[model samples]
Target: MDIHEFLELPHRFRWGGVGGDDCMTFPASWALKCVGVDPAEDLRGTYRTREEAHAIVDNYGGELAFMDSHLAKIGAKRVQHPETGDIGLIKAMTGETAVDQIETQIGAIRFGPLWACIHPGGIRATPAEFVAVWRLTA
Candidate 1:
């Protein structure tokens, strides 16, 4: 599917099933699918909580490091600007406070201008001024 088609897809949040959409699953799935690549059957089930997800990145050093590692793993190249089909890595508050401190989440850029993310209600769009974009390479 093309970028336009991908954007037109209905957005929903599912923790472990890839039926329509989810934050962690959508960007990679859409990017891969756009190029005729079938993304993993299940990109869920491993990490179910914030702590578990954080641990996955912590194991690879930190957020940026984890992104770097994933880029290498997927053969994707980091780009300075947003393109139609590039995946965006973003940092935003998790809305929960820990010891009076706010936690942040790293999510993908499914689309831009108004970068979209999955939320409990549905897809949420945020400004792209602070997101990092990457282009997937075959």
Candidate 2:
């Protein structure tokens, strides 16, 4: 399915460990699989943070190729459309950049920092708190 179709899926806020925690981790991958993209082939299993995932999707041609191939499977293009939910690549923020300084001051808190924007909702919604939304067209 296209990113728009993927975005249409009901999103449950994911944190971690089968319930909720902080990172979007499995939810994002699951979302992609829900949209018909094979996680084993499309995603790298070693990502420790959303930022790492975003970096891969951005700089790694292999990951982009995976997204492109899957988009074709759903008859969707990678074009940025206003009404579609694009795959959101995110990262964690720490130190003074965190959403809550006090909470992070004691240790390290991971926050969803939007790295990549995907369109539509049916595909998948990562557990990480959504920071922004975008649409893909054409």
- TM-scores for candidates 1 onward, in order: 0.72, 0.30
Off by over 4 Å in 1: 16-22, 36-43, 96-103, 110-112
**lDDT of every model, 2 decimals:** 0.62, 0.34
- Model 1 lDDT tens row, 13-80: 66543455545566767656755453334345665655666676698787667666655566677888
Candidate 2, backbone clash total: 30
lDDT of 2 by residue, 53-124 (tens): 446655635434534444455444433322224443233333333454331100011113323222221122
| Number of backbone-clashing residue pairs for each candidate, in the order shown | 1, 30
Off by over 4 Å in 2: 1-34, 49-75, 84-138
Candidate 1: worst-modelled 10 consecutive residues by lDDT? 34-43
